[model samples]
Target: MKKGILILAGIFAMTFVSCKEDAAKKVKEENVEMAEGRDAKNTDFPVMSFAKTEHDFGTINEGDVVEHKFEFTNTGKAPLVIVSAKGSCGCTVPQWPKDPIAPGAKGEMLVKFNSSGKPNQQTKQVTITANTETGKEIIKIKASVTPKAKPVSGTPVSK
Candidate 1:
């Protein structure tokens, strides 16, 4: 009986030690993962770089739709994510890529400016918000438009 009791106690001690070691290992792994996540959140890198900071669309006629494309490159180590893009007014509309751009990849943003209600020399700006090393990237586009003169009607004369 005495021998059996000693063996059971020994087995229980061994099991407890093994469980404690496993718990410690799990905690260590969790700490490492948390550290990595925090680092990623704080990391910043440029996803794209524009050849020209701004685009200028020459003079355009009223009621005409003017379109332009702004090109850029992923100049960072990580993929580039564009959060959102917005135009200064309703006359200008912008379209951007929905997917993340990998490093060294190329991307573009297409912009269309409607001159239906716009007149005279005009300058517009398109703001792009991105997840990059710089936090946010802003790009501007400008244009000038001339509305066509109304046609003059002549009085009908009897021939």
Candidate 2:
């Protein structure tokens, strides 16, 4: 029975890998056509490069609002145009540039995470849609929220 189950899993894995390979090949062919009329020196697809893809705030107090700026550059020959950046939830918001980033130029995205009613380890992701080779990218924001310490009934306030 164990051997039969192992064979079934192997077959499933093979099928999944084959499907993934087919999708990758189709994307590659589309990219090749995307660069057809572009500059001779640049590929048809734009390349987006970021200084960092994840940021950790370590530990923050509850009700704190944290902000981070993600720096990125257009390393490809073509201009990088980001269509939209959407956050994972309402408490997490991302602001991206409306203008296109010319090749070799730099841009930034501002992401704010509010820990209003949230606690513990929180992670939020921002999905970016762009005209880059991969067409999409994701950035992560993480933080450990600690609630405010409460005072005992007999405790005296220190002034």
Candidate 3:
């Protein structure tokens, strides 16, 4: 029984070592690929130049829907392709252009924030994924919401 156990332990150790070596090799190859990609991006990348990074809606009542357009310019050598734009929350939605913008071209994205059920101060972020230098860009929206008062319900008072 002891001999059989030893053989099993040896096989397990060998498999574990082989897997570790394979993982290390894969990591090294991935690192090299990433480095090459970075070099390419450094040489030719799209730059996003926004007129404003943040917008303030001031004070709004609850259930108010507000929207704003953020303008940007592709001030780089390569065309700008926005992969995706995501909002931080469901209440905030962003719409961006699907077509790529040529260098030195202008574009705009519309962001809407629904103030339903959200009261007091609120801040939201929109993350844009693109082939830019940093690969990601962030824009923010802020607002101060005035909550609606709840109505009291009970017996009707005498007129």
Candidate 4:
């Protein structure tokens, strides 16, 4: 009776394995079809060409708020649509155009950085999601921040 039970369990496991393989093959076929479709439309993808990929603020004081505009041109056959732009941290913010940019047209994204608590040399990145080729683009901003000086301990203040 024990041998018969073991054989039944083995048969069940084999059936499950066969079903999993069949499902995997179906999924693989679907993925291949999707890839083929994407390849066909690859030629129509928009291209985002930026004038400068990185901006340097040189030197800035702490607690200062600064902004920079990044210029770009859609140098592709299709219209360029920027879906979203995200900064690396809360102190960094980005603003981008919501409308679609036509081929050969130009656009700009504004990045704002607040050096309130940030000190020393800092670099931040902005990730832009768009319908352009590669689907995502990255831009950078760097700055050398001069921190504020602290007062001496137990020192008398002079008015």
Candidate 5:
């Protein structure tokens, strides 16, 4: 009777330990699955696409003010909001639309390049910050300027 009782007690203890371990593993797996689901739903913004990424002014005369329009469309499921537009240098200025663009909607950014003090081959970059997944978009402008000819000096010479 003593032997039978000891064997029975040992079997009961082993069974209880196995059941507890299985329950703990199941809870851990569930927690991990829930965390993954939450991460997938936490996107801040959507994606955007630009119609034209680069602009070439070709050859611009000195002291000329040139402007170009950069067009873009919202290609994602959320609304696109442009926070600000910044130029690489003071000679270049950028302006963005104030209103938010819905999905599949279009918008434009106006950029002006002042060539007053700029000369030779110049390249300028404009950074646009918006409520998009990528956060910032970059646009580039390039121009070549020809300097004005110097005035001729008056001189008398005998041939």
Candidate 6:
């Protein structure tokens, strides 16, 4: 009777452990699915194809503000949704679409850079979070900021 009771208890413990592992695995799978979204398994997830990922503004004077429009297209079967866009620094601002772009539709990202205190060969990055498979993308802008030019007095310099 003692042997039978010990065997029964061991079997119950084994079953409970197996069930707990299975439950954990199920929860992990569900979490993955939730993080990836329902279309995660789809091969044709939204593709963010930028016409140009980087822009060169050449040389700009200090305190100058410049703008650029980055064109892009959704080349995937799924709709492209730009979740958020942020600049690398406060002086750089990015504007992106707030709506979902249909497949093959065109869109643009407007980025503005304020070179007030920025100097030299400055590279600004705009990180975009989107519904694409990779989930994030980056666009860059380069500019060389020159010092503010000193104004010349109208009066001629006396030698």
Candidate maximizing lDDT:
3
| Model 2 C-alpha lDDT per residue in residues 11-109, reported as the tens digit of each score | 999888775545565567666777774646555677878999999988999999999999999998888899999999999999999999999999999
Name the better of 1 and 6 by TM-score.
6
User: Residue 122 in model 1: shift from native, Å?
Assistant: 0.8
Backbone clash pairs for candidate 5 read none
lDDT of 5 by residue, 1-159 (tens): 999999999999988777555556557877889999997897756556888899999999989999999998888888888899899999999999898899888888899999987879999999989878778989999999877665667865559
**Candidate 1: where are CA atoms >4 Å away?**
1-44, 151-159
Candidate lDDT values, in order: 0.83, 0.90, 0.95, 0.94, 0.87, 0.93
TM-score of each: 0.66, 0.67, 0.77, 0.80, 0.69, 0.70
**lDDT of each residue in 1-159, candidate 3, tens digit only:** 999999999999998877555455556777789999878767678899999999999999999999999999999999999999999999999999999999999999999999999999999999999999899999999999999998678957779
TM for candidate 5 is: 0.69
Candidate 6 lDDT by residue in tens digits, 34-126:
878865656888999999999999999999999999999999999999999999999999999999999999999999999998878899899
Q: Write the per-residue lDDT of candidate 4 for residues 123-159, one digit (tens) a residue.
A: 9999999997688999999999999997889998889
Q: Between the candidate structures 1 and 2, which one is better when assessed by TM-score?
A: 2
- State the TM-score for model 3: 0.77
What are the RMSD figures for all models against the true structure? 17.1, 9.0, 6.2, 6.9, 17.7, 12.6
Question: Which residue segments of model 4 deviate by more than 4 Å?
Answer: 1-22, 27-41
Model 4 lDDT vs. the true structure?
Answer: 0.94
Q: Write down the RMSD of candidate 4 (Cα, Å).
A: 6.9
Model 2: how far residue 74 lies from native, Å:
0.4
Task: List clash counts for every candidate, in order.
Answer: 1, 1, 0, 0, 0, 0
Error of 1 at 90 (Å): 0.9
Model 2's lDDT to the true fold? 0.90
